[model samples]
Target chain A: MSQFAPPVVKIEGITKVFGQGETAVHALRGVSLEIEQGEFVAIMGASGSGKTTLMNILGCLDIPTEGDYWIRNLNVADLDEEQLSVVRSQLIGFVFQSFNLIPRTSAAQNVELPLAYQGVSLSERRKRALAALESVGLGDRGRHEPQELSGGQQQRVAIARALVTNPAMVLADEPTGALDTQSTKEILELLHKINAMGSTVIVITHEEEVARAARRMIRLRDGQVVEDTKWVA
Target chain B: MGGLGLREVWRFAARGITANRMRSSLTVLGVLIGVSSVIVLTAVGNGSALAVKQGIEKLGTNSILVMSSGGAGRFSRSSNSNAKGLTIADAKALNDPATAPDVKMAAPILNASGTCTYGNLSSTPQNITGTWASYFEASNSPIDKGYYWSNDDVVAGRPVVIIGTTVATDLFGTDSPLNEVIRCKGQSVTVVGVMKSKGSTGGFQDADSIVIAPITFVQRSMSGYGSLSQIQVEATNASTTTAAMDEVTTIMSAQHKIKAGANADYRVLNQASILASSTTSSHTLTVLLAAIAAISLLVGGIGITNIMLVSVTERTREIGIRKAIGAPKSAILTQFLIEAMLLSLMGGISGVALGVGISHFTVLGVKPVVSLTSVLLAFIVSALVGLIFGGWPANRAASLRPIEALRYE
Candidate 1:
């Protein structure tokens, strides 16, 4: 692929350090990567390999200690807190391992939260939220709260929330970590369907089965990338 | 899309509050109690103050009274009595415009307690006021029937009397006391007129339980004495009462042959002075109660602060989620502040209703006059309390980093 196409996400020599002095912990040491538009990528690592820190920086939730991060050709590393939040809302959607849907809020309302923060009118927000819920095949459960849904269905609602704003990319952190094998397979399949429909997706997982679902896989160890491979399907 | 609109933030706050119904209601209740007490106490205070003022006004705004004081009246009946006290001559001097220019009318009052009887009914000690006919108009007491004893009656020491309504009822019942003869103080006197019912003055004195006659009749026929009790002076107008009192003091000093620096045997009490003293005491009481009410409001503010801090800590995850979804710090701060303000505003409204209801329905010791100013003050103070108290917690919530808040568990 030509670099001139401008990858959706680009990072070079990014480092994240926590604390200072003798007790300093280097979470990400000189990490570099590029993700093209509409790409389905998986980052695999054990708990101490700093994959979560990389995910945090990529989602714009935290800034790197050093190095440049570009998302959609905008310098993410240099952006202010307010600018970072806009980038997070307009460019990246997050799916956590715990689903993270507000407990008492209905699935549709949860999906509408990002749009509401974006200052969308009430009617437009409701319409978009319902449409996103329908796309996740939970059209009949629009008013159902997270507690009332099954694990796999809650994950679907979260994915709907993630896609409600039509973000440039969706970042999933252990998306199926808390699910049973059947639900996990269903969630992975849903992600695959989303990817097939031209949405870029990044999955962070320690499980090989989850990583295998993506065409491009990067393995991390000791806060550094050790293997980068792409399968020729 | 750049920032959250105030409308959106408000809706979000409403949703958040409703999601935890108990907590919101409890917080609202705190503010309600504070505001209601403030309004109610102020109403009661205002009502009592008005009542006192009206009572003092009923005593006649243009009247001044001169009475014996400093134990001078104690030796009035003794043979070796030296204190001149208040005398008929003093009243006569005060009535002279050249001597006391502001004095419009002066009446010599010789008060005596007498028993009145007619047919088979009798009254307990009825007060006998002996004065000129002008005393009726000066004291704001008007005769309802017949006529007051005239100057001719005073000159002749006539056996005629003007009885109050209560005394009239006691002596004659349904019968007309117009010309009926009533026995008083073992002397027979014809009822020449009936004074109108002057219910009560200064809250305690029964104005209608009296018999009015000529000062000469009181001194000669009733008391069998030659001493005067007090002098009641009426100024030309309400504004001239102090001037009238001063002129009366000067004339009385010369009449009694007293030096300028010496304390006169009698004290001149003006209506304005009495009104001012009463008003000041009532105002002080109102201020004390208002202070207590303000303290209650302060306690309410503390309650708001306590709950808001807890809410900030409890909603850490929610704050993190909002931050993640592009809610700016200003948005989060506004969201929480609007929530606090709404709670207090609603509380203030309900408190006003509650206060007005209580004031109208219940029988407070005072009349409970609900002024618009008091209600507005209570409302504004409640909102200020919300803002001042909610600021700290909202700031804490806004300053939280998304990663740290999200990881707060």
Candidate 2:
């Protein structure tokens, strides 16, 4: 939104190696990136391109092995597991491709989970959860469990859950990977509307159509960024 | 750390348990069996112990019995050719205050069993004890109806008798037996007093099926005055019973010319010693029953652990989802731990109720006495079992990594 504001995410040359010795696999090799606030960006990569690893680090679910990662000026590497949990609850939201809603729980309750981890009171959590569901165009489906809902409806519930915390960024890992073409279009349009509301959005995907919906595109090849471009649609 | 309050955690735990109703109920049943058995078995042991105590106490706590070792024991009469029999003279010596200071009174009893008849009714009494009036006081048999025969009755060889409740009910029916003449062993005797009902003792010996008469009359009419059967000695008080026994034994051994520590012709039965030995045996039985029940409780605890482990494994994906949504480790831990605790605590409470209810009825002819200590102990132990057994699975659930959990199928 502004050129003067510092980037919401900044990472130095970061490397992530899984295991040790000669058997160790390098998932991320000295990659550097910055993502600004209010930017709807898509990170495109094939399987094993280190995109998922980078998303994990940015979401504070993990820390870099050899470099520093800062989320809103807080050094992620310096924070412990408990502080990382707080950051995830208060600052970041995640939407998985599988719509990982807890079984036997209502959609409204699922949306309220992040706020619950943030220690929100029950009444306040309910109000915010209802508002989030309303924004996701499923206000009346709040009480339905995931099993009772369609795949698209479950994904919408997950999206509502991601947005309920008013996080700094919403990281969707192939949000429409399991959806039909019609559901994908609807989900892409919802992401557009969410981005227009001045919230930063990141969609990680291997699909060209999904990446095409974002204003900015970053492509990864072999654990390193190969292309970065801005598209005016 | 502070997000999930105790109440919220409890609700979550309750929901988790209800989600798998069949499994949870089975686990609860296991704990219920363990706790209830602990209470029931211990109560049975306590009941038998109390029954024994009551039986011995009816014999009078301050009394001691000096019987001839020539017989099978105190209850039976079998001649042993090598041993000398107890006599009336030995009873008189125990009654002397200067030689046996702790002795309050002494009565010599000659037991004879015979059919008693009044009018056309007849009944065989288990014991027809012929003794002086002092036997009534020493043996704790109180007179329920008429007055006891005087000392003059013994000197004059009077045919006066006292009948037990069972004998009175048998020979006289509802009619009062006071001043009525009854034939016992072909000797006519006047019923002077009827002893109070003592009920059946230890479910074996019938204390209310006996007849009592003056020793001189029984000797003249039935058994000849060769030797007395047993000497019933009453101490000054319960605390001096051991002293009275020691004094009687010493005097009898000297009178019989038996050396110290040698095999005497007689045996002394102290009620206090019998009480202590019986109490000790019953205590052992109680401990044994409790120990066996504890093993079942331990198995129930193991059942909890097994069920919790299965729950953790089954809910791995769910745990992953919660962790991804920013649930702290402690919250997950608390949720699972509380679920296990609720199961066991429910079982324990229900077990207590069931056990107490069962104890109200007689089992194996022993009336159970429910001890408060066993109830409290069983409950506390059950709760601890839940906490301790649930710990491993809860920790396993909590320490799971968010990324790995989310990726879990």
Candidate 3:
């Protein structure tokens, strides 16, 4: 991989230690990595592994204890909760494993979530929310709440929410973990389409099938990256 | 999106409230009861104050009366007892160039309670006051029939009297007592005039009363030969009346020859002055009640905080999803705040309705004039309670991290 390019994610000598004193656990130990913009990357690790921690750091959801992390030129490690929220709201859209839609909220409202944080006017928020849902082919079902939607439809709504802000990247953690095979395929295809749209996409999961869908893989064992590979799909 | 925040708050609170329907209702009920109580009690207090004010106004706020002080009007509240009784000397002093320049007029009153008779018809003892002609203007006493007797009656000691409405009813029915001869207190006095119905003035029926000959007749015949009882003095206007009072007090003291620190033998009193004192006391009581009512609103605010806390706990996943989709902590806080305000505003509205109802009933059972001030006070208080109480829990909701919230099962 070329190092001179504009990298979407850059980590230098990152170490994430959990707890304090002698009983502390080192979840990431001086790990360093870089991924360029528009790259579809996958992070894989078993239970107790720190792949999710690395994913969080790249997503600006967590700060590394003892290193520098840059996302689209902004330092993640130095950002406070407010700064992090700004980055999270405007730069990196997130889709969780369980299709974490707001319970009792309508699909359109869930999609409009990012715009609300952006201080969009009411009409603009509604218009953009509807457009985002329409892109996911769920326009007619905007009024349907989370529970009324299928697993696939719910994931689509989550994806719509992530895409609504036109973020620099989409950070998805186990995006298909709770879906059936059919819904899983649908979710993967949605991520694939979002990846093709020029935004960098990072998927964090332990599943091999999910990892294979990404263009590059960074595999972790325990707390260290053991394999970094690019697979032709 | 509406800054009203109520729409959003209600939308969200509906979820929390629905989860434990009975519990929420009970809590709302408690709050409602507290709110209504505040409104009701305040209305009652305000209503009573108004009645007292009206009664005082009827007695004339501008009139000054001098009554016999301690040890004089001792046995009878009606009699201007004590060594304090205003003498003809004070009445004469009212016109003195050295002292009472601002004194518009003064009525030297000699009050007598006695029966009046015409031929064979006898009436009960009525309130008979021997006063100057200026008594009509100062005390708002009106004449219904015949002209008042001239100053000749007082100067020459002519036997004549002015009769009140009650005396007219009891003695003459409706035949009119003007130009009639009546024996009063064992003296034959000709009726010269009849006083119009003054209705009730400070709980005393003034219409059914009579006025007799000057202080001389009342002292010698009516009150067992008592000295002059009281003097009513009127000032040109209510504004300069306080200064006029100072002048009167100084002159009277000079006449009575009392040193400083001695208990006054005579009491210079005014219904308007008494009313002002009563208003101060009533205002204190009102403020006290309003403070207690304000506390109930605080309790209502706390109730909102507690309920919102429970809501935050229950919807942990929702917060996670919102944050994941780029909803910031501020957004979350605003959402929760809106919900809280909405709940309280609704409760406030309900409470206002309840308050008005209670106030209305308060006046209905007994006449209480519920004014605009009381209603306005209740509204401002309730809304303030909502804002202050809802603030904390909403902030808490907004502070939750997306990751932590997501991790919540």
Chain B TM (all candidates): 0.90, 0.92, 0.74
DockQ measured for candidate 2 = 0.50
Summarize candidate 3's per-residue lDDT along A1-233 as a digit string, tens digits: 35566688888988899999998999998888888878899999998789888877777766778989887788776677777778888888888788888777789877876776777766788899898898888999999999999988998998999999998888999888888998888888888888887778899998889998999999888788888898676
RMSD of 2: 3.9
lDDT tens readout by residue for model 1, B1-409: 3335665666667876786889888888888988998888888888888888887787689989887754433245463355576777888888898888899999888888878898789975457878887787778778899987789888898989999899988878878899999888888989999988876554667778998888888888766566577788899998887788889888888987879798667788987888899889989978887888888888888888888888888889888877876677777888888877887887888988888887784346677888899899999988888898988888899889998888987
TM per candidate comes to: 0.87, 0.86, 0.82
- Error in Å for residue B157 of model 1: 2.2
Model 2: pairs clashing at backbone N, Cα or C within 3 Å? none
Lowest lDDT block of 10, candidate 1 chain B: B71-80
Candidate 1 Cα deviation (angstroms), residue A203: 1.4
Count of clashing pairs, candidate 3: 10
Docking class of 3: acceptable
Is candidate 1 or 2 superior in DockQ?
2
The TM-score, computed over Cα atoms with residue i paired to residue i, of candidate 3 is 0.82
Error of 2 at A164 (Å): 3.2
Ranked by TM-score, top first: 1, 2, 3
Give a tens-digit lDDT track for model 1, residues A1-233: 34467898999999999999999999999999999988899999999999999999998888899999999899985688777878888888889898888767788888988887777888888899999888888999999989999999999999999998888899999999999999999899989988888788999999999999999999999889999999854
DockQ of each: 0.45, 0.50, 0.37
How many residue pairs clash per model? 0, 0, 10
